[model samples]
Structures are given as structure tokens and as C-alpha cells.
Target: KSVGLNQVILRYASDKHERIYGMGEQYSSLEHKGKRIPIITAEQGIGRGKQPVTFAFNRVFMGSGGNWHTTYTAIPHYVTSAARSVFLTNYSYAEFDFTDDETISILSTTPTNTLCGQIIGARSIPETVAAYTEYSGRMEPLPEWAYANGVILGMTGGSAKVRKVASMLRDAGVPLAGLWLQDWGGIRNTSIGIERVWWNWELDESNYPDWHALREEAAMNGTRLLTYTNPFLMDARGPKGRLYREAKEAGYMVQTVAGGVYRLGHEPGVSFGLLDLTNPAAVRWIEDVLHDMLKNTGAVGWMADFGEYLPFDCVLHSGEAPIAVHNRYPEDWAALNRRAMIRAGLGSKNEGGNGEGMFYSRSASSQTPRHTPLMWLGDQLVSWDAHDGMKSAVLGMLQGGLSGLALSHSDIGGYTATPGRHRTRELLMRWMELSALSDVVFRTHQGNRPLHNAQPWDTPELLDHLRDFARLHRALAPYRAELMRESSLTGMPLTRPLFMHYPHDVVASRVATQFLVGRDILAAPVMDRKTSRVHVYLPPGDTWLDVWTTQQAPAQPTGPRHGHGVWLTVDAPMGWPAVFIR
Candidate 1:
């Protein structure tokens, strides 16, 4: 009866009226029924492009997953409008078929697998999330330190320039939480120019001569210090690159199936090695390295980068096959960092409950929220499009909320490389407006280019809007804390789709641009450039108030009792966002 060697297929029936939601982060409709969902993760670069060949090859290379919309994270979970939810526990290649309106079929790529799934019968979606969180772990609330605006400088800048930039932000009246020194890691050269390499985990002593003293000074200015960390190690020839040599000698690196250490070539560093965190000893080694870095630089936390690098043809120290552990790699990497932080006495609620310790990540899976506190929308292009711009971010957050990552954010001005030009002032301001009203933490990054950093100081026209929106974000603190508390106690996302609230409302079910922030406030950030007005749909059964103008919009004009909504075209200039409360 077996048709395939390592494939397991699942089939089930679904009511015609039931609608499905949840599949990690996808750019599809809010209602996921009648769709074929591939549960795989890959490095799907920035936005939609003409390079279909590249995307298609990566999709095949990655085994399974959506080619265009799916990115670094994938959670095999879904909730139905019938008050039923299903959580697939498998982490390997799998496909979900909801096309049969009457049936749901799933095919797992690995055989001899136990067909295990958690089905919950809840009264509502929120309740379903609560059950899911109880099964996985609940996400903790972010501390006040994380609420402020942040900036990441480019690689050309040294310690003094960084200090100057921090001062510039303060002088410009920008409320800054911290200055993220991304280039603090060792420097290198790629096709682009001098860049920071991922492999060398140590500070570049030449660039940051007084690293310890400068970090202490920056801390005094209320600007906390943060750095970046990834799993790649550059070649072993660099005089200061001891991590590579040591990891290989101790058998702490991932080995190719043929034997010997596995190496790969990439940008910034012509070639590099990978750290196999599946090896307990390797995890310990990384923890020690991070502890040393924290002690030396007085940094409060780090940016845990690049966990989506597990190869299908590689070896692991845990003795588990690569196919079995590939999809769960990000969650494991998060746990490794979490343990490292705890060992360094900088864990979340380690010393006191002030929420002092945290790390920002871009890669995740279903178990990621249990170990990580925050996840940012990965490197996005500097354009306004559905693929990787404001629209994608909005949908991504809503999807992430459904996936159980309540604490999320995006690069404020975008992070993709654009030749000869930085993000326009209009784009930056519009993005700032979006970040202001959303539940995601606010942060900025200089796109990947060497010297092309997007700084608010460069555009004097945006200073007022930037400062005002930051104040707006701070003003929403109390309400945001309430949302975080609910997320911590239960598993509801901070920002979820309108359909989650008005499931029966026909309009709300299809509106992905609008979302509810903690049940009362609705944020519809302008995703178009130079747009002055945005249409909003007010769900039936409640009178909605425009928070900006203090005016109420009447309920639905007509339709099935609870399935109706009123549409309102509201004014939304470049710097203003469309937000309402009910």
C-alpha cells in the first residue's frame, strides 16, 4: 500500500462553511481555506522581483515552501472558524491541502512518523490562541527600554562617529532607547566594499579602540549599547580568527556528509564556516564567547542573527537526521541564546523583573516564541510594495500574531541594498507613522550599503513628525502594556486581523490592510506613496471613533446582522496614519 519511500499523507473532512487561519507568515488572504500551503522556510530575498528563476530554485533547494511569499519562518498551525484548531507537531517537509472544501490532506516528507496532532475545540480564536500558548510557551512582555526608538549605523562609521551620531539623535530631540553597533563585529571586504563579517564574533579592536570606555559613556547618556551575532565563522586564516580553528579542532562545526568541516562562501566574507549548535559543546562555547563580549563591552543584549542555515546533507552532534531537525533549527538557536543570556546573568527576569535582558531575532518557527522575546521583519527593500514593504509588514504582523509571536517589529526605513540612493524622506516618515500606531517595537536600520545610512538628522523636515510619532508610541504605552499582559496571560497577538474580531463580517474577513491593536484600537497604516486618504471598514455591532479627529463613524448601513461593516475614507497624509477606536 506504500506509494512513496519517506512520505506520510493525511486526509480529513471540513465543513463547507469553515475558514482556516494561521500558517506562520504568508502574504495570502486572511482566510486560508482552499489553498495549498507548503510548510518550509528559506532565504527568500527582500521583495518581488523579475528573477523567478532564483526564487524557484531556492524553493526547490529548500525542499518545500511557498516560493514568493513565505520567508524565514513557518509554523504548522491553523485555527478554523468552526471553533476548532489543529497544530501539526512535525518539523520536516510537509504540505497542507485545503482545496477539497470538504477535506484537509497533509503529506509529511519523513516516514515511520507518529501521526500526532493537537486538536482543540475552543469557543473563539482568542481562546484557541490561549490553548496554543499553554501548549507552547507564553511570550513575556517587553520592558520599557525596548519601547523607545532605536538606530543601527552602517559599517564605515567608527566608535567616535557612532558616539557623534548618538549625540546627533539626542540633539535632534529624538527619544532613543539605544544605539545598535552592527559593525562592531570584525570587518572584512566583499564585492560591495568593506563590510562586517559574521564569523568573527569578537570586537574589531582597530575600529573601536576604546570600546569598553565608549560603551560606558554611551550608557551614561541613556543610550544602551547592542551588537549583532550570527552562527557563521569566517575562514581560519585571519590572525584574530580563533573561533574557526578551535571549533574545527573540537569537532564543534557542522561536517559535510563526506567528512571534514562544512564550509560555504558568502558575501562580506568570501567564504565562512558554520557553528553546529546541535552540539552541546558548541553551544557552551558560544555561550562563553557571548558572556565574554557582554562583560567586555557592557552591552545589555545582542541581535541573534541567521539561524535558518541548517543543511539537508550535513551532520549533527545530536545524532538526529538533518531532515528531522531542519525546520526546528531556529527555535533551537533561540534556546541556545536564551540559555547563554541566563548563564551570563542577563536573562529575562534573571536579576529583577524589570525585563532587563532580551535579544532581537528574524528567524523563527512554532517553538520560537517560547525561547525568544522579539522578532523583527527581516531585511526589506526600500520600496512600497506588497512583497516587502509596509503592506507586507502589516500582513506579516497580523500573521505573526496568529502564529503566536505577539512581540514583533520591522526595520523602520527598510534594509535592502539600493544603488546610489537611500530611502526617500517620504518613505521614512510614512514608515515611522506605521510603526507609531502598530504594536511592534520601533527600530531603524541603515540599509545594507556601506555608507548609505538613513538617519532622521539628514532630513530636517521629518524631525517634527519623527519626534511626534515617537511620543505617540510612548502615549500608547499603558494600552500596549495591557495588550502585553493579555498576551503573557493568554496567547492573543497584539495586532491581529479584523476577521479575528468580526469573523462573520464579510468585509472584515477580506481586509488585510486593517488590524485591531489589542481589541479596541484599529490601525490602517498607509502603504502607498503620496497617499492622502485611506478607506477603512468599521465592523458592525459597535460605533467606531476616529481617534485623530474625535468623530464617530456610524455602524454598518445594511447586510446580515453581524456580517456587515461601514466603509469610511479617512484623511491620511504622508506622515499621518489611519487609526480608530471602538
Candidate 2:
């Protein structure tokens, strides 16, 4: 019922002991049973309500550091312990209340009165997840090379720096899949980092005077080049900002309530306008721009980023209520990127692994999966803190899997940083251990401020550590390839919670922090600093083989076998994590 203008309240009966999970890409514990999750797409705040740090960051950055429920991708859907799921299709502002033990309440502010969805059921938890994904839609597989290669190293600045580092890594024998240059267009020294310019889309000739030649060289070295992009076109006025002026003159920009161009950003030259996707002309213009860029540069892919900043008060060219179109913006954005790739002859009709170029995004909702086959957990703080860092990426994959985001990864070693929160060599190595198992494409980021964080090439030990993991990841290519085939055909997530495999084992069903990679491997990455021992729960279905255990008592089967599951502690020193093959 409507409690006020454009608002409706919804409630559903729930089992008293139901353990609910899923709210796409959340940085929290796997269960949301007693939590309040706001279903809105935006920048994930710093700290994420984690403590004294959150307080300081909130006071300074005005809550941009984020809280537990703050997510780039939040869907109005969930799966419970009983193996049932449902998804709401509403795009308006909404929140999920699991505070009540026997009921789930959703309060959503929308332009309409109806809140609708479909209840999904199957024989088991995995089957139910499959059913839910089938009902929604399955994202296609990424190109085969994504799984076949080693790590995609993140770097910035200009072509000179990239070439220098790439040569160094090549000399170091680090297996290279791709190089992610987020500053291909140009760069700006911000309070955050040496981030690229917000307005420029064209390649900065000054930065990459040898662009075409570099692409050819990288390709010859078996490395694909990836760039970065977002939805906003910063409203700069001059010959340099031709696209912005042209878009405005063609009426492709979203408008203010008073009917002038709506601009956003806290600083000058940073403020920008969004392309009104509702306008077919605007959609065509941006897609064509993207298509031409990809083809001309011979770039295999790019990061299709930031679709969460659309304003609910802006006016679209199609005359639709902004509030009604808000949450669906990410879906539209992904679809547009997909169309652009397809237009450039980089799309596959059957399976997605046909060397079809791919893009990854950070925003999603109910329908965002089918279009955005690749999703990355948004920027994480450069700390080991679980609320918004390495540990949070674990939750991101577990929870994101339940929501049909089959291919997900995080910026290795984390991204965001403040004064005190910085990356350490220990943190970077430990974060890589966590990622080596869960992510589809092993990738790293230099963080918002590269000056504050440690990169893979920061130290000799870090470089050797990266090389070890890269070799291990490459060795798993055949296994991962099969996993991808399964994910593409069956909608079964590549990273999954334990309950899906050991449903009858009560203790195993609730285990967090550890997850399954496909149906055979169980990974337990250490989530804390200054720890060499990791406690792991071995599920009942199979007797596990330890991959790498050192300097500790052999793991013993302990506790009452809850369907034969038991606990074991093992040595997991730096660079070595607990991974079991079942």
C-alpha cells in the first residue's frame, strides 16, 4: 500500500529460521537474516559502516566510504536456506527488512502501486539457483582467453610507463594475460589518485603517440589491452570537448526539471552530463563512438563502468519518470555496451567464448546479468578490513553467485584509500591468495592512490609471489575452462556457497569466508593479517586432498560428523592459502 507519494509497502511470510542471502554484490556476511539492505545502485561508501574509520571518513567524505548494505549492484531478489527464491521487478527506491524473524518486508518508493515478481522452486538449493537464473537470464561466458591466461595487471600513467613495466614483468617471467590501463584517454592528479580525466573519451595522443603500434606489439606478446570508461560526459566547453558540445546540441543530454542540461560533479571540469539512453539518437551516437574506438585501437575490451549515478530527478528525452528508470539504468548501459561490441563484430551467437571481446561493469540489478555477463566488485578500500576490502570480496562472490552473477572478480589488493588506510606487501599477497581461486580472470588494480599502495612490482618478494600464483592459475586453465562451459550452459555459478554442494550438512551449509570453485575445489583464503594458520571446515561429501600445507600439525577430522563434515586447522603462511581438492 502507498504510505506516501510514489511509495508502496510489501511483506511476505518467512520461515522462522530461514537464512536469507543474495542482494547482488554486497560487501557483508553471506546471511542477511537480521539485516536491513537498501536496494539502491550507487557508489559503495568507504569503510562501509565498519568502525572508527567509517566515522572519520564519513565526517570528511560525507559517507562516500559506504556502509554494509551500500552496493554498486543491489537487486530486489533473494534466496533462502529452504532453496526457494523470488525477484521483484520494480526499479524505484527500495529496501529489504530481515529484522523480523517471521516476515520479510519491503518498502519501495515507486511511481506505480504494484510490486510484482515470480517465486522460483526446484528440488534442491543448486537446482533452485539454476531455476532462478534461468527465469531471470544467464550472462554469457567471457572470451576463452580470459580463463586461459594468467593475471591482468593494473597500471596507469602513459604508454612509456606501461611499456617499461610490461618489459620488466616479461623479464621476471610473470605470466601476462592483459594490461589494464585506466588512463588511456588522459590523467588528472586528484585527491583520490592519478585518475584519468572524466570528460575525455578520445585517446590522448600526447599520452599514447604510439597507440596503434603498441596494440600490435601487445597482441604479438599474447596480451590483450583493456581500457576504462564510464557513463558520464563531463560538461567541458571548448574544442577539446567536442563530444559534450555535440551531445548537448543534439538534445542527447538528460535535462533538469526546468529543462536545461543537468550537470553533476563536485569540481569544475569534473561535472558532467549523462547520455539520455531513452533517446534512440543518443544511444546510437554513444554506441557508435564506442564501436569505432574499439575497432580503431584494436582493443579487445574495456571496463564498462559506473551506471549507478543516474539522478532520479533528471528528465529524459522519452518523458519517462526518472525515478522509474533509475535502477534499470545499469541494465540499459550494459545492453548498450553489448550492442556496441556486437556491431564491431566481437560478439558470439552461440557460446560467449568465441574470442568475442568482453567488458566488465560494477552496477547491476534484476535484469543486469544477461547484458553484463562480467561484473567486478566496485572499488574496495586498500585494507584487509572485511567491511570494504579483501574479505568483502569473498562475500561479494558468495552473495553475487546466489544472484546469478556467475563471473565476478575484484581489484586485487583493493582500490580505495584514505590517510591511514593503505596497502601493505602482506595485504597485497594475502589478497592475491583469496582472488587466485574465486575470480574468473585474475586481475589487479593500483588503487585510487598508487602512491599509498604496494604494486606487484613493488618488491622482489611480491613479484615472485605474483609469479607463483600466476603459474598456479595457468595450470588450472583446463579445469576452469570446463567450469566456464558449465556456467554458460547451466547458469550454475563458478563461485558458490558450501550449502549448494553439502545441503544436508548443517554446519557446512552455514560456513562463510570459504567457498567452492566449481564442484571439486574448496578454497579457504586467509582473511586476516599477521596470521599463518587458517581454520577450515571440511564438508562431508568427499575426502579432501590438501594442495599446500606447511609447518603445522596435519589437519584432523574433528567434531561430530554433521553428515561427515569436520573441522581442521592448517598452516597457511603468507603466499600460501588453504585450498582443498575434493
Candidate 3:
């Protein structure tokens, strides 16, 4: 049988029964057992639940006494079955088939010799999946400093201005851990009258004078620098241009349907193409550039941006189909960076091992948890609405199996509207409290607006408060480091959703506005102005202890502690979010 979209063919010998299980939630057992289940190969947005496809074996159509079966459960190990199995070679696309009693053969419209005649055994499925995860690479632990309060200077100011701000933060007694330098560090220099040979990522020494000394000063003050780098290479420019040409020659860059290098639409100035990480040589070329940046600039890590621009019209170096590889590119991108770090001996598992590597990615895949240790919610509005949206984003990532997240700093003092010093202070304090528990706590504000500045010194009182909060973040680094280790080893999230704790609680599923920091601390950040109190859902069982006053609230089946259901009122004067521990 030939496989097409949302369909597959399975060939089986006569006289054999197949059983299968575990494709997400099942309405009925027969839905995914002993049948050939239809699978859709497509791209899904973040927070969207698993691929929109089902698998079961109970439903099967037989031809000439040959039976086909579908199973949701991928076997624990590779087992040679009497059934012949065929699937989309790409794992990101759904795989729906079962191995029982007969040899099952799967056919795809885009069949590759690599997948033809491959025999799978039932006993090795789980190990195979686990090995695949390991093969992709395990998640790396973030640096200790990443957990502390950080200042993300928008592109509004030049490098000198950023240095001055860093100096001011230090003078204010703020224990800053990192400085996020935006696009000012580099500019694309084009050869005169030549369209090709554009040089991006070249340091602007004139603007950033004494760059080495600046990095050293920050390092001495216990702060590191994180600069931004985009994957989009300028059309025919510099090393990237050369690399692109080389890759195209070697067939290592993705190609379009017309046999042209894929062009990224957002960056129209240059014809952009993605490097195929499946190609070892392509990975090596990218790694060399990363290593050179670290060795020369004293930079710590990268703020990997723009991975969301993966076009559906590109092909992989491994000859895999384009549609299935779009979302999976970020995983491969992060993996390439991690492997580079490991190759540099920075991530060697040695005593006092300096394995500090992470990426601020905008896209993800199923095995993203194994690559990106630190990911932030995608671009969001700078408004109170964003405050509520942040909760949903965090919970969504947690449920989707991400290990760590950075709630945008706009939740703090920065807003797109007119600035209110008092209100901004309140927001900043509350946001700081919540951010202190995150894997990365970096402050950022919107750009291009005079009134939307998030500089810590917006007010003398606010500056003092910011300093205090920054110090608290530094003090919590030891505890945060322990949690980071735990998150790396276990599949637990730093910020957890309610379902993680109360899987069966119907009420918890609807409550995405709040979450637990680790397993003990619960946080509810106010997302609206003039809202003094908010309702919190408590799962049945343990009583919770208030973080501020250490007051105990008795667990009840329903009703409010004061006036609302398990409500925690914010003391506006103190300006802190309601936090509790169970």
C-alpha cells in the first residue's frame, strides 16, 4: 500500500493478532489498538497539545488475508514482528502502527532508501526512544549566574551607555549577574559597490571601545555578558556568505522547491538559508564561529534568536522531507551549539567542570527539553494583558515538557503605556519576586518609546528597591543552582503547572493564571491594575503556608479564606505578590 498524507499502508502475514496502546488520551481502547491509525504530518504551535493524530489497532482493513494494525504505544524495544511497519522517517511527524502476529510494511509517498526494509522489534522501542533522546544530546545545566537578577539593556542605547548603566547598577549595590547587550555590539559592513561580501557579526570597535576591558570590568564585578546573534545570514556576506556558498556546494544548506537556497522572508535584504545540522561538516563550521566569539570577545553564551522562521519549503542535507523538519530545526540548532561547547572541552564532566551552555530559543520540538535548558516565552505585548499571558505561557511550556523558562521582564516595571512610578514599583517588586524563582531572571523593556524606559534608576526609591531585589536574587543562587541540577536530571520544570501536582483535578486544568515554583512555593502574580486580590485553586489534601506572614490556611473543599476562594490579598503598600508554600 502507498502512504499519503494522513494515511499509511501496513502489510501483514495471515494468522496473527496485534495489540497497541498509549497515544495520549483515549476515548475508547479500540480507538488505538489492533488497527492502522491515520497519522498527520504537520507543524503545531507552542502549547498546542501533541500532534493532531490518533493510533490504535482494533480498526484494520485486510487485503487478500493481510491485516494492518495501529498502536499508540511505540514498543519498549525494537522487536522483529511478523507485521511489517512503515512510518514517516521523521519522528516529529506522528508514527501510528503496531507490531503483532504479522509482518507489517509501511509505505510513504516520499520513501527513502534509508527507511526501506527496516525491521523493528517490540522489546526495544522504549530503549530505542531513549537512545534517540540521548543521541540528540542531553540537556545541559545553566551557569550559576544565569539564575540571578540580570539587566537586559534594549537596543535604545549604545554600548557606552550600556557600560554606564552597568556601572550605575554596581554603584547602587545591585548584585547583577549578567548584562544583556542587544544589537549595538555589531553591524553589517558591506563592501563598497558590491552586493555580495556583507560582513555581519563584526564587532563595532568604534562604538564599543575597549571591549575587552569592559568585559573584564563586568566580570570583576561578578557579572557576565550575553550578546545577541541571529541565524539568518546576510545574502552573500562575509564568513557566513562564504559558508553559505561552501554549504551550497557541499549540499549542506536547505534548498527550495526550485532547487534554490531557501530564503527567509523576514530578512529580505539577504537570501537566508538554514544550515543542516544533520551534516557534521556544517555543524563544525557553525561551531568554529561560536568558539571564535567566545575566545576573542570574552562572551559567555548566546541569545539564539529567530529560530521561528523555519520555512516549510526547505530540504535537509540528509534528504529528509521539509515539512516534517520545520519545528525540529530548533532542536537541531540547540544541539549543534551544545555539541560545539562539548567539543571545546567547556562541557567536559571533569572536576570544577565549566560546562556552562544554553540558548534563548524561540521555537521548540518534542526533544527540545534535551537541548535548550533555558527558553523564554515568545514576544509578547508590554501590557497588563501580558502579565496574565505570561502565566499561560509558562504553564503551557511546563505542560509541553520544557525544563526552564524566562518570563519576560516587561512584567516588572516596564509598560507600553504612560509610566506610573508608584504602580511601576509595585509591578517591579511583584515581578521580581516571581522572577527570582525562574531559571533566568533578566529585566528588559520595550524600545523606541520615550516613556517606556525600564532602567533601574527610573526612581530613587525604585532604584533602591531594585538593588535590594537584585541582592536577594544573588543570595538565592545557591538554592537555584540545586534546582537547576534537579531539572536537568529529572524531567521536572522549574516553574510547574497545576496539572503536574494535581493531575486529576478538574478545577486545576482551567487555572493557568498561577503556578508553583519548584514543588513547595506557589505564586499568583496580579495581572490587572486595581486588582488587590485574586482567587487561587487549592488541590484537595495539604494545607498551604503563606510565604509573607507564615500564616496557615486550612484546606477546604470550597469557598474563600477571606472573601474569595483561597484568596490572597495584596497589601498595596508593601507591593508583593501573594506567595505560599505547602
Candidate 4:
């Protein structure tokens, strides 16, 4: 063993017929056999948009060839078709080798002793997840309003603009539940134009002069508020920066091995200091900041962002090296927000408390689901390709559910569009149709550039579809809530892969384009643009009814109306997602 590092390789014999799943959020295929997965969280560019768009601060460059496997979240846990499961309990980067037919090996390097846990008698995926959650923790129930669709309005517009948008949604008769305000605090200019680099946890009164009034207006409209927050603090040398100075004096900021603050350079000329959450004083410092935001702003929650960049050579107040702290950083970030929310009298589901609180995050580890309830798929491009486009998001949702992210969503219509190019009406509608059927909250965001926004009311046709989906989401709230409760109690995801239920159906195991919401409803969203019909494989042993058309199709041993494992090419008209009930 090396001085600050211990490497362990665990191997097990496997059968040739075994199917494996998990390794957190993978876009390429749900089954993870014969693949090498690196457990690291970093932003690999948003694959390929129609035009060239670059965000250097995030390491996104102008390129057509994209890396779809680069992810913001990872869980080093898996369940095999052989009725066995494995979980790497340590928080460190590791390489998983599942390519060998006879042997599965996991090589991990960490500062702490390697500890892995295995589950026996895991006959199915759901059972494995339940056992894992018992060792970790289960999620809490989200507020009722979060089950509906939401729209992301970038923070550039002043408080008045938010009110105007809220009014627009109400006038348009759209059932809106949440409004996402990203970087409401402020922004700074970096080499890649302007980005949200300001670290002051307080809202920018200059842009939001009537911030309190805006919150009251949103509450009146029955909408919950979610703002953005990261775990970084800008240079403490700036005037009126009490947060930085206090953290520095209290020895709460992460330091390099040379005894300097561990800083990150987002661009050529901008840098920010990282918070050392391992320190008890530092945890209290960050919690106080969040508590003040909740008490003053009337905000219910935040979009916890950027927990993936802890330096491996840094030192912590707990004296643990970065290898032991890197992957666990996201869990710490989640804990910091959750504790602060609870301390401020905002908890999940009110549990005899005063208020309900929630936070949707992009980066998380194996235990994050136990702390935060909702998860949003990280940034995506506005493309239709199955690799990194809207369809890939469907695959992500399915994988995330099996891995225990019960409530998950993606940026509707994508979040990175080419500058000077507009997102087409058809593209947004297609994405909306898919988002409408998924188990996650349907939310839209203006990409990196403020001008290139995915506003649903762009066209009359688009607005009509958006309003319809919002209504549908609200109508299904009761059913969604039931599924959420089940998820919380059993640690199973609200959404499930088709094979999870029809395990014997060979075709269901290979179908990744469609998914089952809860237990009975099946959602098969049209993946390609301009496609009017989709092929669906109805699993055997049940009579399924089409939700769009109340026609009954029998699946084996019931009637000769439809054959077992019948593949139907159903018409999926524009603005409609192909759905069925079992």
C-alpha cells in the first residue's frame, strides 16, 4: 500500500447468461455487461447540437463527435441477472470491468480501506434496490406541487419579468407548479462570454428589487420557487465578502498540500475557492448561509449544482485526503442543504413541521437518494439522435430509476442550443411530448445563452401542446403521488424498465425506447422528429388497453384478438405520446 493510497481489486465468477445493470447514469444501453465504466463526475460537452455552440468554462467545445458516457452522477452498484448484487461502499474513483464472461472485476483506489458489500437472494432488480437502500437510506416524499410541470426562466431578467411570465402562464391556462430561477444571485464575465460565477449566497437586489414581492406573487399563483446554489465561494479579497473571510479564519476552506486555498479556474482569468465541508465549523457556515436565503427570500428550495470538482491533492479539516472525499462530496453537499433546510423549519412532507422543503441536484453518489428526493438529468443538446439527444434522456431516466433515483427529469428541449440559432417549434414539441409521459417533473430551461431560450409559447402550435401536457401532468398527480409513496417505502423507482415486470419476455429486456410508469401504464414516446407512428411490443400474459384509443388488445391465453408479444405500429400523431394501460 502506498502512503495516502490503497488499491483493491475484487473479482467474482459470472455465468455467460447473466445480464447486469447499474453504474449510475449511462446513456448507451441499460444493460452494462461487456463494458468498462469509469466512476467519475465531470461535464463532457452536450454531444452535438444542430449548430456549433461552445462553453469553455464547462470544457464544452465546438465539435460534432461527442462523448455520451461522461456523466455528472455515478453509483458504484450493480445487480446481475444471476440473482446477485454488489456495491462498492467506499467513495473513490474506480474502474469496473464487466467484459469477461467468467469474471467481474472492480479496481478502486482510495485513501481509506476498501469496503464492498454484497447482497444475497436478490431475485430481481427491485429487491436489490430495496436491500441497497436499507443499507444506505430511502428518499423522502416531495411536495405535491413539484409533481406538475415547470419552466426554467434564466435569472438575467429582473423580478418584474418573472411576474410577467407567471401572468403569461396563468392567462394561457397552463397548469404550472414551479418556476426555476437559475443564478438569481448574480453573474460574472469569463473568457467564455458571461456565466454564473458570483459566489455571494445573497440574492442580487439590483436585478430583483422586488424579490419579496415576486415570491409572494408566485405563492399566490400556486407555484413553488427553486433557485440555484453551488458549493464554491469567489475570491474572499473582494469588499463586503464576509463569507470568505469567516470561512478562511475558521479554517473551513479546502487547502492545497502547500497550505494555500484550493481554487479552481473556470476560465483564463477567473478562479473560485472550494468549501471544505469535512469541517464541522465549515458545515455550520454553509448551513447558516442557506438558512438565511430561505428565511429572507421566501424560496422553498434550490438547484444544488457543481459537486464534482474536489482536487485529489487537497487537504481537509478532518485530515482526510481528497481521494476519500472526492466522490462523497456530493453526499456532503446534499447533507449540507438538507440540514440547513430542516434547521430553517423546512422539511420534506411537513412531518408535523411548519413547511415542506426539497432540492433537485445534478451530481450525486450512492447515498444521495436518501438525502435529496428529486434529481434532474444534467445538460443535454437539442438533437434527436438516440446517442445524446432527447431519446438518450429516456434511457437515462430508465437507468436512474433502477439505480434508485426515484424522481428524475431532464432539461426539456435540451439546455445547450447553438447561439444565433433558434430552437425549432417541432423540436420543443417533440421533447415536450416525451417529458409529458415520463415519471420525472417536466421542466424547460433556456440553454447557456440567455437569448436562446426554450420558451414553450414560441408558436401557437407549440403553446397548445405545452398546455395540454401540463393539464395531463396535473390530472395524473394522484397516481404519481401513489407511485412516489411506494418508491419511498420500498426504495424502488417510480418508473421501471419493462423487463422489471415481464421478466420472462425476451423482447422487453431489449426494448430501451419505452418504459413503464408505476406498474400499469406504459409510455412509448416518439424518438425521431416528424415520425407519426411508433412500434410497441406488448408483453405477454395480460390484456392491455390503449389509453389514446380505448381498444383492447389481448396478450396470450386470453383471446385470439392479438398474439402474445404482439408488435403494434400505432399512429403517434404530433403532440401525443403513445401510451397504454395493462
The estimated TM-scores of all candidates read 0.92, 0.94, 0.69, 0.91
Better of 3 and 4 by TM-score: 4
Model 1 pairs in collision: 199-233, 199-234
Q: Give the alpha-carbon lDDT of every model.
A: 0.74, 0.81, 0.48, 0.74
TM-score result, candidate 3:
0.69
Cα lDDT tens digits, model 3, 139-248, are 44566566654544343244677777777777777767666665434544332211121224445566677778878887887777766665555556544466566667
On lDDT, the stronger of 1 and 3 is 1
- RMSD list, candidates in order: 3.1, 2.8, 11.3, 3.5
How much is the lDDT of residue 132 in candidate 3?
Answer: 33
Poorest lDDT segment (10 consecutive residues) of candidate 2: 550-559
Q: Show where candidate 1 strays beyond 4 Å.
A: 1-5, 48-66, 148-156, 192-195, 350-354, 418-422, 450-453, 557-560
Q: What's the distance in Å from true for residue 130, model 2?
A: 1.2
Over 1-582, each residue of candidate 4 has an lDDT whose tens digit, in order, gives 535547878887887678877677777657778887888766534552222333332344333233555666777877665547787787878888888988988889855665566655576667877887776677766776677444433344667777777676777777777777775676564566434536778887877888877777778877877777888877645542667677777778899888878877746756678899898888888989999888887777778887887888888888887877888998899888888788777785454445567778888888888788688887776777666677777787777776677788887777665544455667778788777778457677766655565577655666678788877776777888888888888887877888777655657778999889888898888878788999998887777899979988876642225344788989999866789999
Whole-structure CA lDDT of model 1: 0.74
Model 2, residue 397: distance off in Å is: 1.3
Top lDDT hit: 2
Error of 1 at 550 (Å): 0.8
Tens digits of lDDT, candidate 1, 340-408: 667666766744433566788788888888888888777666667776556777777787777778888
